[model samples]
Target: MLWLRSIIYYFLTALIALAISAIAGTVWGVAFALCVVSIACLFHIFNLHRLHRWLENPQVDNVPGSFMLWQEVFDQIYAEVRKQKKAKERLAGTLDRFLSAAEALPDGVVILDDNDRIEWCNPASCEHLSLNRKLDMGQPITHLLRYPSLRDYLKQQDFSHPVIIRITRPAEQTLSAQIVPFDSTRKLLLSRDITQLERVQTVHRDFVANVSHELRTPLTVVGGFIETMIDMPSSDAATRETHLQLMYEQTQRMQRLVEDLLTLSKLESGAQVREEEVDIPQLMQLLRTEANGLSQGRHTVEIGRLDRPRLIGNHDELHSALGNLVSNAIRYTPPGGTITIGWEKRDDTACFTCRDTGIGIAPEHIPRLTERFYRVDRGRSRNTGGTGLGLAIVKHILHRHQAQMIITSDLGKGSEFAVKFPQARVIE
Candidate 1:
């Protein structure tokens, strides 16, 4: 329609020129028509120049205006330019949001070009791979990472699994890195910090091994005694009774071990604990009696500084935790040694302290005492009939009750285990 309008306007001009030629002398009328045509051509040329100038630095507000059909031409061009500008803005906004999300992610993200060169990366990516965002842009990834395993991984076309690599750029870290091809020419290099995950896996493996080792000894002893008794069916009653007694002890040890394992599992499961006021003085009396029975009148279990202040926690769990501590003191202390149990307010925290005059722990062993099945002396621990989960159980129970245990010992002198409950948990 616009082209047709332009053609019609030129046709009308021609008709008017012919009309002028017929009315006046051919020479004068022809000259007048040429002059009019020349003026019209100049006006059209000026508008065209304005349109070209506006197009060079196009903006909606500065669109060229014209008097004739050129006005429609300029208006259409302006509308098209405005529509494109809006679309571009929308795309720009989307890109900005995508970058922001990537930046906020904890996992590292790097965009790689076809040449395996870094194009863009988030802060986490820079920290994981030790890459400088400004300096490493367009740098080949292989050169910066410099790990043989990573190089081998990149060489493979398939990325079904991530490559684990240890890096020491900023600190010791284990990174799991994988490449995902998004386009034919570009890829995403993603990385995650698996240091903590790896540690947990290692701990899990060690825990299983320790549990198996601990259970195997008692099982072997029980099996051996059963086999001996079965082979000697004609033996005397006293002999058979001894064999049966040893079997009973081994079975008892296994039972205790299994029970402790179950208790530790429940503590670690983050189950809700039953909360009640724990009468500390009454609980201490119970512990002293249990300790004397375990001691067999060997060590003297005495109560000292028995404060009346109680605690807010699960009574059964507190009893178990405190009982474990007292029993440990009895087992480690020699005959005639005095084990003192105390409940006292030290500053704002209520403390339950058990001090024993026994073969004390070395400084180095104190740090790892709470680890599962960690025994300072394996032979002595076994002879004492310890499950080796007592302290570990104590640690977990204390944690649940928002308490802290402090240990102080001098080698060969004695050790003191003090559990301090938080002020909030203390019922003064």
Candidate 2:
């Protein structure tokens, strides 16, 4: 192409010069035409000198801050470099944001290449799926994960449904996993931990079964008693009194059980609570006075400054919670055992303590104390008319208020229940 264009240019220039010379020969002379041709030749030689000098001088290629792009070859190369630079910058930004968001996600994320090789993994994936990213990257996804269910699920290539795996290799966890395929090449594996949700569901199921079973016996006893009384010809005075008292006690027991069930359900279902500034001093005084009245000179009561700590919560609920604690203390304590009510500011928290020289709880039973209907000693609890839900209610109350509870007991040294009220719920 270069040779053809150069040949065409020379022919065109020769034709133009010949025409000029022919016209000049007729007007002037052969000598004048020769002079015109010579001048044109000299001018061409001068331009060639400048072009050759540039090639000889290396500095001529250098411009301010960069190589000169005066030549066609340099210009083409420079344009290609600029395009690549911009593309690199755009790709770098996209990669940075993608990695940042992937890191922030709570669920596990795994990226696979077209060859089903592990390309990338998030921190959560490493923790939940038990795979070391450093050793697993670039490895086949199947060889590393080694989960039979997952392997079978992936082989089917069905993304229409998510497969849940109860992970239990290094530790126990539940995962809801989904595989999303892209362009028949790459795949995205995502998994979320649903251990807590599964645990709650199991607890609910067990609770329903146990509650129904427990109620059956009480209901059956009451039913048989009612039937017998109905068939007893309206009952004699002695029999009537005996049956009536027993029925009343059973009725009360049912009432307490129903009330506790409702309370627990409300607490679990995120029920709204009324919060107010609870005066610790006034509340303590009231509880002490109530304890005295209920004591009937049985137990000695001691009250302290309580650091004048203030808390914020529903007064009515707090009253019920506090009253239950005090009542339990009094009921469990021996005639001469001392009961002390006090509060103190520890760090940013206000702790309300109810220490009693009462019947202490066993170590093995402490863990399930907050469980609904759990009893350390069932016979003792029923004899004392305890509903087996006092600690459960206290636990839920503290949970709603974002507080905490600590129960410390020695087999025979009496128990101390310290309820830690967080600063978020404290007025002072």
lDDT of 2 by residue, 1-428 (tens): 44465566556666666676687653444455556568656755654565455446524234112121224444554466667778988999999999999988999999988877889999998876778978999988888665788878878878899888887767788888889886668999888999999999987897787577556756776787788888996688898778778878777877877888898778779878778788878888899999998888899988864687678888877877877888888888888998898888889898888889987888998888888777777777767777777878888887777878888987777988888887887776
Minimal lDDT window, size 10, model 1: 24-33
- Model 2 residue 214 lDDT? 57
Clashing pairs in 2: none
Off by over 4 Å in 1: 1-43, 66-69, 156-158, 167-172
Q: List the residue pairs that clash in candidate 1.
A: none
What shift in Å separates residue 185 of candidate 2 from its native position after superposition? 3.4
Residue 251, candidate 1: how far off, in angstroms?
A: 0.7
Per-model TM against the reference: 0.88, 0.71
Writing each residue's lDDT as its tens digit, candidate 1 over 79-198 gives: 998899999999999999999999999999999999999999999988887799999999999899867888889988679999999987667789999999999999999999999999
Off by over 4 Å in 2: 1-88, 113-115, 155-160, 168-170, 210-217, 264-282, 289-313, 331-338, 343-351, 399-404, 420-428
lDDT of 1 at 260: 99
